[model samples]
Target chain A: MRDLSLHIIDIVQNSVRADASLVNLTIEISGEVLIIRIGDNGCGMTAETLQKVTDPFYTTRTTRKVGLGLPFFKQSAEQSGGELIIESEVGVGTVVTATLGLHHLDRPPMGDLSETVSLVMSGNPQVDIVFTCKDDKNEFTLVTTEVKEILGDLDISMPKVTRFLREMIEENLIELKLKIE
Target chain B: MTKVKSLDDLKKMREQLQSQVSLRVNSETPEKMVQVKVSMATCGIASGAKEIMNLFVNELDRRAIDAVITQTGCMGYCFAEPTIEVTIPGKEPVVFGYVNAQKANEIIEQYVVAGNLVDGIIPANYETVKDQKNK
Candidate 1:
């Protein structure tokens, strides 16, 4: 909502609630465009649910009547001179891709992305998340499975682990710098 | 710039913690320990629950408390954004409302450590789905 990372966190929560064991988020940038693509190996939706997911008023969650995650993401992309696309199949998975203008003023900043990715890991420790970003020259990726392999039976949700994870991600992202400008 | 992080670095870090008990936290009976669950719905996230979650995780670890901090969905207390449910073993769970950084600190110090009741405690005035199932 307030930032692109927040929207990302929200969308990933949907995948988590759907029991996704794997989630992949990729950010690709060209000259003037940036893409946020999130793919989840969660329980895919029925055609009925997919039809209403972007409606802002229809939600599978019984906790409340309104679901604004997708709608908000779509709006954020379009406001920045881009588009949002969601593709899914029953019993398979779902992928949400939002492309926006890198120079657009309305596009939200990629706020605290390391924290966002870390929080996602903190909450769903068992779920493996692969985060990747690329420009023409720089590329960075964080794969939880590889981290888990190294840690070997340690809980990823441990406070020290999360802190270290966030720091590593932050430094890598900063090193890459994401500026194809 | 700092050295770019790689798995090799984490491998070194793991050796230190692997020797500690933090690795075996859940394996040895979790229900006996404290459980702190922060509401993480869209409303809660927008209201700063993520920061609260980090505080609980880091501060609890700092104070050497053996509590499990986790994230949960909305607790039907939408009006009181940024809520959390704290459950100490052998005690009924209590949901606290409007939890900010200072309040979270008070919780860790007073309620969590000293076992004293604090303000802003939201009564379980209604039954949740899990509660109904148990009944």
Candidate 2:
């Protein structure tokens, strides 16, 4: 909730909890607009569930039910002069997209994304994630499998792994910003 | 800016030495220095890892526990996040999961300060390749 990456992480957790096998996250930044899209091949939500999900008090899980995550995300998008859209098909999949005015002061800061990616890749080793980051000038793709192959059985909990993820994200952002400049 | 060519060069750097020397020179140093690594991976963040990380850092700083806090990626137990790894120098690194502010204090007081293991540990059987090959 502190940043777009945190929101993405929260939503992806819901997807994983829904038994998702594949999750695709796309971030597109152009001019002053930033769009984030996440699609998951998980058990899609029912119409009733979807309607209540943004209520901040409804949750399907029995573990601490007062769900505020999705609502928070929706509010964040709206406050940023953007919108949140969700589409789901029962037994098919789910997709959530949030567009934000990057220059808007109301928009939450982009939190630590390198930590987010590394966490997801390491935590859900069986589940695949395709992450794409793009701007007017440059784009980068990160697939979980490639990192796993590179790391082998080395603990992703290590500082080196975190450093690699941080470096990757920072470098890509710098490259993209340079192109814009 | 001159680039450091080797580890030795890094050891002679201004920032690192200054921090280390200052830490050493400072009086009222705690008996022990607890090194805490907060896992800020995607799973950890989803499970409120940021809040937990901040809580620990603030609490430790408030109490002036000679702790050097940092962050790591994922600890692989997506279900039981936000995970935290604590190392007390001579002791083995212990990873705790589902950490909250309350639990973090207990860790700082009991496990970190008193050397007692709290609950919420993922089994040690979950080994990395280094551990597997060593076995």
Candidate 3:
């Protein structure tokens, strides 16, 4: 992936395909580190599967021999002088926490997180995604359920709502002293 | 700096959108509506499937098309990294590859809305027949 947001969405797609009803993602910048945590309530993974998911050549896709999402994400973090961790239980769920040096020279930009979040929601409106990002003094959160409540009978995936939400996220990130890459 | 939006702002948008927005997703009979499923696997993502997905969602909504847009896992067509499966109700699903924003728009306007065939179709909709024969 070219950017962190692409990696984020790729991982979220895994959760979605695993039939996750809810996914929680958080991005926090503290000191010189940026931490991203993605937790999902989905089909989960077995010990064997978890062990294999991070291997560069390990893949669940029968069509190809390699699955690059987790490996690339791990590489992205490590290259940025950080690390990646994953905890999963079969029939339970999975949580991935990756950290990267905020000022690392090789770190990819944050990319368009608003686009990532909105596309996931619009395509899988039945799933609830909670996104939170913070930078020391400032914090912002977008809970799909909360938005859905306020929206009443409307779909959050609607073009106008999606545009509005995108702007809202953009402004919040800017407020938190971060810019979309 | 402009204020970061809160739910209150969204509430206001909802009020205005109530008049303009279509409850199209809810009003349409799901079984009869068009289903656009974009492959969102690692290969697809690397090739910009997410942007293509966004285009499909917003464009389909804007065109007043009552369609269901979803993201699916790899269809075992790694060669066609960024592929999409479009299913118009009562018809078989067709897989299209190398889709970008332009292709998405064309799919919506011609193939999706007008039900006319377009280029880039993978022709594997008949793969089920091959599978059956193998069995």
Candidate 4:
């Protein structure tokens, strides 16, 4: 993943693949640290699989031999003087947390997050994804469940709905621009 | 944050805007709408697939083209990063590579809208898992 947003997208895809109906993704920037967490109620890994998830060579998917998603995200965080952690149970769920030094030179930019959210939603309309981005000065949260309620059985991935979701995300995140500077 | 007071208020608003919203209850039927799948794996994102996906969505809306856009995992074309598969009604799916915003625009204007094939069509050498299943 080139940016933090893309990293989030990669990790969330794992949850979707795990048969998770809900995924909660959080991105927080506080002081000098940037933090990301993805929690999912999915068919979580056994302790054995969780132990090796960070290994670039280990993958649960049979279609591929190497699963680089977690390893790449771990590398990105660790390169910025931070750490990645995974907590999972066999049938309960899993949560992945990564912290990065925000000001570190190696930290990739926080790329197009609205696009990231839209892509995830478009790809998994049946799943509920709750995304929250918080900084010291501002915070924005979007729950697809709520959006669905507003939409009333109209698919969220429909062109107008997607357009609305993209604009809603972008419009909310725009409040954080002044805070970023 | 304070747009609607309650569920009833939101529902009222939804009813007001429902006329403008097209209802496509099923996104799976390719015969009903143009089906587009953008590869969104890590490599794809690193290669600007995110931007291309957004371009397709926004441009399709601007053109009022009824298309179902989706994001999918890598199609084992890491070398051909930023690839997208477009399936028009009654047509075989075509995968296009190296799709930036410009190429995506060309795809929309030429291939998707006009039914005229443009450049950047990668040979559909690999079969998707879904394709294999249907076969």
Highest-TM-score candidate:
1
Q: By descending DockQ, how would the candidates be arranged? A: 3, 1, 4, 2
lDDT of 1 at B18: 62
TM per model? Answer: 0.89, 0.62, 0.87, 0.82
Across B1-135, the per-residue lDDT of candidate 3 in tens digits comes to: 567787799999888766553454344345566778888888899999988888877787678665667778777776776899988988999999889788888888899889999998988744533255566
Give a tens-digit lDDT track for model 2, residues B1-135.
433132233223334433543575353232245667777544577678866765665566466455645556555566788889888867778888778888888988888778888988766777644455566
Q: Candidate 3 clashing pairs? A: none
TM-score of chain A of each: 0.95, 0.88, 0.93, 0.94
For model 3 the local lDDT of residue B50 reads 82
Candidate 2 lDDT, A1-181, residue by residue in tens: 6677788767877777778899998888878988889899999999988888888878664334467668888999999999999999899999999999988989888776655665555445567788788887778777766655554433333333433454565566565552111
| Candidate 1 residue-wise lDDT, B51-114, digit = tens | 8988987897797666656677777677788999999878999999999999999998999889
Mark the 10 consecutive residues where model 4 chain A has the least summed lDDT. A172-181
Candidate 1 vs candidate 2: the TM-score winner is: 1
lDDT score for residue A139 of model 1 = 93
| Native-referenced Cα lDDT, model 3 | 0.81
Residue B10 of model 1, lDDT score: 89
Question: Mind giving the per-residue lDDT tens digits that candidate 4 earns over A110-173?
Answer: 8777777877886677789998889887877778888787776555565655766766677667
**Candidate 2 docking category?**
incorrect
Worst 10 residues of 3 chain A by lDDT: A154-163
Higher-scoring candidate on lDDT, 3 or 4: 3
RMSD of each: 2.9, 11.0, 3.0, 4.2
Each candidate structure's count of clashing pairs:
0, 1, 0, 0
